[model samples]
Every structure is written in C-alpha cells, then in structure tokens.
Target: MTLKAYRTHFYKELEAFYPQEEYETFFKVLAQEYLKLAAYEIPLNFQLELDEAQRNLFDKALSRLQQNEPLQYIVASTEFYGFPFQLSPAVLIPRPETEELVDWIYTDFKNTSCTILDIGTGSGAIAVSLAKLLPEAKVTAIDVSEDALKIAEANASSNAVNVQFIKQDILDCQALDRSYDVIVSNPPYVRDLEKVEIKANVLNYEPHLALFVEDQNALIFYKKIAELAIQALQPNGILYFEINQYLSVETVGLLKNIGFSQVELRDDFAGKPRMIKAQH
Candidate 1:
C-alpha cells in the first residue's frame, strides 16, 4: 500500500463524518499522530500499517471520531500558547478564547511581580502559561476534580512552570488565605438551553461539568468566583474571565454587582464578547 492509497481510503472513511476540507486536515493530523505513535520510523511518504493490531487501533480511533469526539480527545493532548499539554476526559480541552484570556493577563503582568490565581484550572493551561511568562509572579490554580488536577500537574511540569495546583471546588473555597493581584477563570458558563449551539465534537468529548451551567443560573461559577474574589484579591485587584458571548452584559453586570470597578468586555478573534476584566 502506498501513502496515496492510504490517504485516499482514510479520506473516504472520514467523509461520512466530516466535510472534504475538514477531512483533509483530519486525515493528515491522524496520520501524523499515527506516525508519532510508531516512533516516526514510518515516514510520511509510506503507507500506514494495515496489520491487525495497527488496524484495530486505527479503527477504534476512527469509530470515536465518527461519534463526533474531538480529535484532541482522541489524541489525549493539545497545544496551547506554544506549549503541549496532556489532556483527558477528566478535563475540558483548552480553547482559543482562553488563550486570549492568558495573553491579556500576560501582557498586563508579564514584567510585574503580581500574584495570580486561576480558578477552575482545567489542564492548568492558564496558570502554567502565566507562570512561564511571569516567572516572578506566584501562580496558584484550583480545581474541584482530583483527576483533572493530576493532568494539570503533569501539564505544569511539561511546560516547566511552577504552579500550585489545589484540589478544591471553587464553590467550596472558604479557607484560602492568600490574596492575588490578578485572578482569572474560564469557568463553565454554557446554559443548558444553549446546547443546540454547541458542536458535536465538544458535546461528545468534552467534560460537561466543565462546560455547562443550569439554565436558570448560567452565571453560577462567575458569580461564585466573583464573590470569592472579593475576599481573595488584594485591594484594587483585577478579575478576568472567558465569558459566554451571549452573556456579555450579564457577566459585566455580575462584576459590577460584586463591586469590581473598571469592568471591560472584549471580543475574541471571532468578534464574540469572549472575555471580561474588572478591578476590585
């Protein structure tokens, strides 16, 4: 079998689940991952293995993809902010909007010694990125799931950044003693009613606990984190969030209601109101 033949068959198989343009990229990425799994001994020009064992692995992965699982989940890793992070079902994959949030914080505090805290620190993407960018700042990250924290710790190590990973729910975070100069979160904000708008890849592969909120209480985590921020931040501290685009006004309102001044909402690359920042 030649590489061309393998790619042709792969694209045909994926066409049932994806469009041609997406099939092209997905096929290439899957081929790359497969080559890496084989220790790169299999060159890109060669065909993928059709042996029983390798075929089984490919079939399993393709089956999951057909179910609309994210390719990152299938690979169990993703790249964010030029750093590779290990991912699992225990944590939601990091998103580009959250990358903007990190970049915003990094630009504001990269040269400062301000302390930072990241709530709901799934995959430790934000916390680790901050620590890498601002080595002088102390970074602390908190999450409710120990499994997620384990992946986050590994990601912190992989990024060669020191971040304190705490396994405690933000909703139950009461005994914390430290105050941060800047606090950030990309908490669950998807309202139950907005399920139809979500992509099948996200809905199928990503952890729901990290993606959704009650329909009537879509701002649950934001409200809780803002209330906690009142006591967790130093005077005149800043709070940042990757917010749902539909709830930009509500998110800003929540920050104002919490007494955070200088509230600002910014759009992401897609021009959706995706991030909010405010001062306490």
Candidate 2:
C-alpha cells in the first residue's frame, strides 16, 4: 500500500474508536513506529509488507490501539525530560506535568550537591533525569512494585545514569538512616470520583496504582510523603509534589500543616496549579 493510502485507512479505523484529534495524531505516530521497526526502507515507508509476519505485527499494534491502549505502553518506551525511558504496565507512562516538575527541581538545585529521593518513582524518570542533570548529586528512587523497579532499572541503564533504586511502599518506607536535601514525587492523586473526566486512553492503559486515590482521602499519598519528608529531610530540605489540578490549595495546606515553610505553588503549561514546593 502507498503511504497516502495507509494513512487514510489507519486514520479511518482509528477514528472509529477514538476522538478525531487523537485518531489523527495516533495514526501518524503508528506510521512512524512502523517505519522505524522496518528500518525505514526508502520505498516502503509507512507501508507494511502485507505478508503474514508483517501483517501479524501490524494487526497486534492495531488491536492494542483499538482497545485504547496507550501507544507508549504498546511500544514499552517513552520520552521524558529529554530522555528516552523504557516502560511497561508495571510503570506509569511519563507525563508532561512530571517533566515540568523535574525541570523545576533541576533548576532549583542546579549548583547544589544535594541528596534527593523520588518517591513512587515510576519508570525512574524523575530520578534518572535528575541524576543525569545533576551528576554530582545523590539520587535515590523508591517504589513498592518490583516489576516497576525492573523497568526503572532498564530506564536508568538506557539513560546511562546511576540511581539508587529501592523497593519499598511509600506508606511503609523504613528509615534509610539519612536525610535528603530534596524529596520529590508525582504520586497518585486522581480520585475514583474523577474517572468520568479521564480519557479512555489513560483510564484503560495507564497503571491505576500510580494514578488513583480514594475519593474519601484523595490526598493520601501527598499526606504520607509529606509526613515522611518532615523527618527524612535535612533542615531546610525541599519537598516538591506534582498534584491534581483541582487540589492546589489542599496540597499546599498539607505541606504547611507538616511545618513546610516558603510553600509555593506553580502552574503547568495549561496554567493549572499543578506543582507545589515547600521547605522543611
């Protein structure tokens, strides 16, 4: 098939299941991945061989796409903080807000030899990115799931950075017998009640353990991480969070109640108050 023909067919099929905007972009992304997988042969750009083997691969990708699986998850990799990261169902796909969180932290401590811990460090994006940017700093990442840690390790290797990866649930994290100069997280803050607002791509494909909190206590992870920082941080150590768009005030309040001073909240590219920074 020609590239034009393939484009039309892919867009039509994708639009049958997803929004027009998403379908259009995903179709282009699909073609790009297919081309890359095929080694980008000049004449065969975006056109599968149509033989059994190529057909099978194409069918599998299309099936997952139709099922609303995120393309990043299907490919098992994503880009964050200008670095490529390996991913899996074990890890939450990186988001732009998380990138912004990393950038803010990187800039805030660019000249310091600080110890940093990224709690709930899915895919190790935040930890590895920080390690790469601040090679002199000590960066440690913690997650409850071993499977997620495996992917995070792979990502750290791919990024060519060293990070301490620990397997521990945030709620039950043991004392590491040390204090950090900065603690950061983009923990699960989405409440079950907000499921209606989540797109099918996210609700169906992303790991819920990294995305959700109980409606009765949507701030659970934020509270727990804040409490930990109160003791785990060195005096004047910083705590940062990428929070739910609707919970800016509540997140700031939680930080203040934990005795974090100079608490500041900032907006994302969309102007939603999505990040909070506080000092212990």
Candidate 3:
C-alpha cells in the first residue's frame, strides 16, 4: 500500500485509544526513525509503495501501541541530554525532571574536575551524561539490580563515555567506600498509593522496582543515601536528588535534620519543586 494510505490506517486505528496527535506523532516517528522520511515528506511520497517488511513493521508497532505499550519502548530508543539512549521494560525511561537535575549539575560543576556518583543508575542516563559533559570528572554509577547495571554499562559505552558501574543496594550498604565531590540519585520515590496518579502505560509496563516505595517509607532511599553522603562526600561535597513533587518540603527537612547545609529545593519546568540540592 501507499505511504499515505498506511499512515491514515495506522493513525485511525490508534486514535480511538489515544489522542489524535499521539498516534499521528507515532507514525511520524516511525517514518523518520525507521524509514528515514519525515511526516511532511510522507505526502510528497504519498504514492510510494511500502515493501512487505516495512508494512509488517508498521502493523506490529500499531498493534503494540494498541496494547498500551510506550512508544519509546516500541521504538527501543529515546533522546536525553542531546544523545540517544536504549530503553526496555527493565528500566524507567528518563523524564524531564531528571534532565533538569542533570543540567543543574552541569551548570554548577561543568569545569571542575571532581568525583561524582549516581545511585540507582538505571540506564545510566545521569552518569553517562555527566561523564560526557564533564569528561575530566571521575564518574561512578550503582544499581541494586544486575539487569539494570548491564543496561547502564551498555549505555555508558554507547554514549562514548567511561563510567564505573557497580551493583550495590543502598538500603543495606553503610558506606560507599570512598569520598565523592558530588552524589546524585533519582531513586524509587513514587509512593505505592500514588499509583492512581500514574498513567496506564507506566503502571502497566515500567519496572516497579525502579519507580515505587511503600508510602510510609517513601523517603527511605533519600534518608539512607543522605546518611551515606554525609560520610562519603568530601567537605563541601553536594548531594542532589530528583524527588517526588508531593514531598518537596519534607525532603528538604530530612536533609536539614541530617545536617546538610545549604539545602535548596528547585522546581522543574512544570514549576513543581521536585529537585533538591544539598551539601555536606
């Protein structure tokens, strides 16, 4: 069938389940990433015939989308920090709040050579990006899940940056062994009760191990990581976290109670205070 005809069919099929723009954009991304053709260019080649393999691929993507799979996982790729990353069900896809957290670090320490560590570094998004931006800095990332570590390691290599990957559960570890100039974590902060607020795609497909915590113990990772940071961080070392939007004040308080001076909470582009930066 022609490209135009296929586009019409694919969009109409998914528009019932998703918004019009969402499905339409999916077609455009499929064309651009898989076909090397832009959405605008599709009309120019409206009469171009799709090969059997290409048609089958489009059908499969549409089928998966209908099943509520995330488009990023369907495409198996995403862009973050101006670079491409591979995604799977094993890792949570990087979000804009985390992007802002990374940029905040770059803004402050772009030129200085320092030791940096990423806790719960699923997919190595933060660690690899920092290593790329601050090439002179020492970068290390850790995850409790070995599967996550493998993906994180691959991402570091694919992004053409070097990072040390280790499998360590922060909740059980008392010390990080060495000091760090800066430590950042985007650990499991979502409360179990907040699952209702999450979208269907994420609740159904993303790894719960990387997204959730017991509501009563929601700040467990932050508290534990902060304690470790107090010991692991060098004098004047900073601790950063991408925290839950609902608990910004409480998170700041925890850091302050733990004796983290210069504690500051910042909002994401959406204006919710979701990122925290503290110092030892």
Candidate 4:
C-alpha cells in the first residue's frame, strides 16, 4: 500500500485509542524506524509503497498500539538525557522528570570527583547519565530484578559510560556497604490507589514492580533509601529522590524526620512537586 494511504488507515485504526497528535507521532516514529523515512520525507514521498515485510511490521505495531502498548516498547528504544536507550518490558521507560533529577545532580557536583549510588536504578538512566555527565564521578546502580540489571548494564555499556550494576533489593537491605558523596533514587512512589489515574498504555505495559507501592505505605521505598543514605552517605552528602506529587509534603517530612537536612522539594517542568533533595 502507498505510505499515504496506509497513514490514513493507521490514523483511523488508532484514533479512538490515542489522541490525534499522539498517533501522528507514532506514525512518524514508526516510519523512521521501519521505512528509514524522515518526517519531512514522509510528506514528500506520500506515494511511496511499503514492501510486504514493512507492511507486516507496521501492522504488528498497529495491533500492539491498539492493545495499549507503549510506542517506545513497540520500537524497543527511547531517548533519555540526549542519549539513546534500549527498552523492554523488564524495565520502566525513563521519564523526562528523571532527567531533571540527573541535571540537578550534575549541576551540583559537576566539578567534584564524587562517589554516587543510584538505588532502584531500573534502566540505569540516572546512573548512566550522571557517569556520562560527570566522568570523574564513580557511579553504582542497583536493582532487584536480574532482567532489569541486565538491561541497565547494557545501557551503561551502550552509552559509553562506566557504571557498576548490582542486584540488590533496597527494601531488604539494612545498610549500604560503603559511603557515597551523592545518593539518588527514583523509586516506586506510585500508590496502589493512584492506578486509576494511570493511562492504559503505562498500566498495561510498564513493569509494575518499578511503578507502584501499597497505599498504606506509599513512601516505603523512600523511607528505606533515606535511612540507608543517612548511614551510607559521607558527611554532608546529598540524597535525591523523584517523588510523587501528591505526597510531596509527606516526603519532605519523612526525610527531615529521618534526620536529613537542607531538605528541598522541587517541581518538574510541569510545576508538579516531583523531585526532592536532602543532605545528611
């Protein structure tokens, strides 16, 4: 079928499942990946015909999209912090707010050769980006899932950055083996009740272990990580977290109550309380 005709069919198939602008983006991304057609070129070559294999691929992607699969997972890749990362159902797709967390750390410790630990580092987005941005810093990332650790390790290698990948469950650990100058985590802060607010694409396709917590203890990961950071951080070391917006005050209070100083909560680009940094 001609690319233009297929594009129309694609929109019609997915129009109910996704926004017009979003499905439009999906087509552009799939076109580039599957057809080697740039967005600009897609318009100019509307008459171009897709081969059997290409049509098959697009059909499969359409089916997946209709099933609420994320386009990144469909493409098996995403961009984070200006670097390309391979994606899978094993790990959570990196979000832009996490990039803000990385930038905050880089801006603070850009010149220092510090030791950093990233707890619950699903795809190693924060750890790898920090290692790349602050080359002199030593970065270590830990996750409970072997599959996630494998993907995170590959991301570190592919990004050309050195990050130690360790398999550890932060909730089960009592103490860290060593101290770090900076410790950060974008842990599972979404509570069970908040599932209603999540989109079908995320709720259906993303890894649940990396995205949720019990409503009774939504700050479970943050509390444990903060406790570990208190004893595992060097004197005056900083701790960072990507927190849930609805629980910002509670998060900051927990950090302070746990003895963290200079506790500051910051909003993401959308002005939602999504990040926090504290000092030991």
The candidate that wins on lDDT is 4
Model 4's number of clashes is 0
Enumerate residue pairs that collide in model 1. Answer: none
Higher-scoring candidate on lDDT, 1 or 4: 4
What lDDT score belongs to each candidate, Candidate 1 first?
A: 0.85, 0.84, 0.91, 0.93
**How close is every model to the real structure, measured as TM-score?**
0.92, 0.91, 0.97, 0.97
Cα error, residue 156 of model 1, in Å, equals: 0.8
Provide the lowest-lDDT 10-residue window in model 3.
Answer: 34-43
- Candidate 1: tens digits of C-alpha lDDT, residues 14-75: 88789899877666667668655342444545654466665566667778878888888888
Which scores better on TM-score, 2 or 3? 3
Query: Model 1 misses residue 257 by how many Å?
Result: 1.6
Say which prediction, candidate 1 or candidate 2, comes out ahead on TM-score. Answer: 1
What residue pairs are clashing in model 4? none
In angstroms, the error of model 1 at 164 is 0.7
State, as a TM-score between 0 and 1, how close model 4 is to the true structure.
0.97
Per-residue C-alpha lDDT of model 4 across residues 65-148, encoded as one tens digit per residue? 999999999999999999889889999999999999999999999988999999998888899999999999999999999999
User: 1 or 2, which is superior by lDDT?
Assistant: 1
| Regions of candidate 1 where Cα sits further than 4 Å from its true position | 37-44, 47-52
